[model samples]
Target: MELFFKYLQYEKRFSPHTITSYQTDLCQFQEYLKEVYDLEDISQADHAIIRSWVVTLVQKDLDSRTIHRKIASLRSFFRFLVQQGKLERNPTLRIKAPKLAKKLPAFIEEDAFTQLLDQSEFSADYKGFRERLILELLYGTGMRLAELTNLKLADIHLASSTLKVLGKGNKERILPLNTSLATSLSQYLVKRQEAFPNNNSPFLFVTDKEAPLYPKYVYRVVKKYMSSVSTAVKNSPHVLRHSFATHLLNRGADLGAIKDLLGHASLAATQVYTHNSIEKLKAVFEKAHPKA
Candidate 1:
């Protein structure tokens, strides 16, 4: 297990959070093995034992997705053990993961998004402008909260109207900023300087003490503003990102372009937003058609 985690961290370059989740899932699997089979090492794992574990997981009322992830983790772990000569054959090779239904992404409506931004009160104060800018950038650029929180002053290219975002796997992508969002960012930067004149945190967003903005703070700011606009959907930063992608697809933006803008590795990841747009179009057509 330690070897597998080291491989994930050093070779696969998994994020800290992802590594932690992998650790948790594997630990749970290990505990089950200890209790059920008295197995203490990967070399003793076999197909029959793994299948019984799957049955046990199902009996525990775990969701299909959770069960699927555990299976995937075990499969990878067994493969690693095989490669390391701990096992002669990988038993999980024939094991299948449970099929999961594709759930549609949640998004804010277009009008509600506009109202949310317009209704957000921003004072001349540094924190107010800074918070507003954070929200604006999330919706405007469709960046993930981790990407936004990790942004540095050097990442912003105001003259080019682009932001250098370091996404998952330490991949860097340049995302463009529109006129309005760029302008708002400029104003907020000035206010930020005034608020923390002597501070040198380099991060674009900072706290009251001029420390770098944490993910929790960004989540709270998004929730606070979104709660004022609508209570239908859960207010969160990712919702703003979904709103950004949905609105873009609604406006006829190309899927490939949207994929690049959102820093997705594959077009399939970007295709989910089309489902939201299609649902919206269906509603509009149903309302307007005479032969309903």
Candidate 2:
């Protein structure tokens, strides 16, 4: 376990959240091994035993994505063990991850998004302004919830209309802001200073008590406002992110640029939005075709 964690920290350069996920997956696998085979060391595990574990996971009715993640974790762990000379060969080499259908992400329409923003509950009060800013920034920048929550005051450059965000794997990227978003952010900064006064919290968004906003607070705020806006789609920050990307794609934005703006590690990850755009085009064609 220590070796795996050290490998994650050094070789893979995974972030704390990703490292934590790997640790959790390994811990769960270890617990399963203990209960079923009374095995403590992964190196002692064999191919048949690993196959049986996969069967058990299937029998337990875990989702395809969850099963895939477990397989990934096991593969990484055993490959590391083999590299360290603890194992003769990797047994998980033949284990196949469950096939999963690609489900297109749900996104809010442009009109619905505009309506939500127009009707959002905003006030001159510090918390109100802070929440409003959070909403604006999420939609405007398409930043991940964790990225937004971890934002530091120094990361924002109002003069340049750009924000430096530290994304997954500790990779940093510069995300640009629009005029409206920059204005909203500036106003919020002024309100934040007045509300917090002498307090020195470096985070961009904070609570009423002047502490940094937690993930749950952000989720609740999104859920509360999104519930009023639309029941057609699930209410989450990620949905807003999807809306942001989809809207950009529908408007003919370049795929490469969108990938960079969203801080995706690869173009393949960003290409999923193209599926949503195609579906929209198909709908329009079906409605407008004279032959139909």
Candidate 3:
């Protein structure tokens, strides 16, 4: 397990959070095997044993998505074992997880976001400027939370109206910003400079003390403002990302363009947003097609 985590950290370049999740999933499975089947060695576990674990997980009331991820962690670990000659065949090779119902991603209406920005009262201080810019960057660029979090001072090119983003797996992409977003960011930079003249933090978004923003800080900031404009079931940075993609698609942006803007490697990931578009189309057809 230690060696696998080392490989994930050094070779796979996976984030500490992702590595920790894989560790947690593996440990839970190991404990289940020990308690239920008295199986100490994971290598000795067979397909039937794995299926029984799946049944137990289902009985424990875990959602299908989570159970699928746990199984995926197991599959990857067993594949590693097979490569290392510890196991002759992967026990999870034929094991299948339950199918999950597709759920469309939720996004705040563009008008709501505009109202939140234009009419809402935010402190006229550097801190408020910084917080507002965070929302604009995520919604305007369609970049992931991690990409926005790791944004470097040099990555923003105001003159070009573009932002260079380092996405999943260290892949970098340049996102062209709208005029409003560019202007907002430019103004925020001036406020930040005046407030923290001696700031040395390389991150784009920082706390009031000029410290780099942490994940929870980002989440809380997003949730507080988003909750005011939207009663969304889930309010986080990703909701802004979904708003970016969904709004673009609704306005007739090409699917491929949205995919590139979101920095998604495969079209499959980007197609999830299309489901939102399809629902709108269905509504229009139902209301206007006269077939109803």
lDDT of 2 at 2: 92
Best by TM-score: 2
Q: What is the TM-score of each predicted model, taking all chains together?
A: 0.91, 0.95, 0.93
Residue 269 error for model 2, in Å? 1.0
For candidate 3, lDDT tens digit of each residue in 14-51? Answer: 77777888999999989988998898877788999999
For residue 276, model 2's alpha carbon misses the true position, in angstroms, by 0.7
Q: Candidate 1: misplaced stretches above 4 Å?
A: 59-61
Is candidate 1 or 3 superior in lDDT? 3
Candidate 3 is scored at a TM of 0.93
Question: What's the true lDDT of residue 63 in model 1?
Answer: 82
| Decoy 1 TM-score against native | 0.91
Between candidates 2 and 3, the TM-score winner: 2
**Per-residue accuracy of model 2 over 1-292 as CA lDDT, tens digit each:** 8978988998888877778888888888888889989999777788888889889888999988888888888899999988888887899999987889688987887888678778876666887887778778888989999999999999999999999999987899999989999999899889888887887888888788878889899988888877877785568899889889999999999999999989998999999999999999999999999975
Best by lDDT: 3
For each candidate, C-alpha RMSD in Å? 2.1, 1.6, 1.7
Instruction: Judge candidate 3 at residue 121 and give its lDDT.
Output: 70
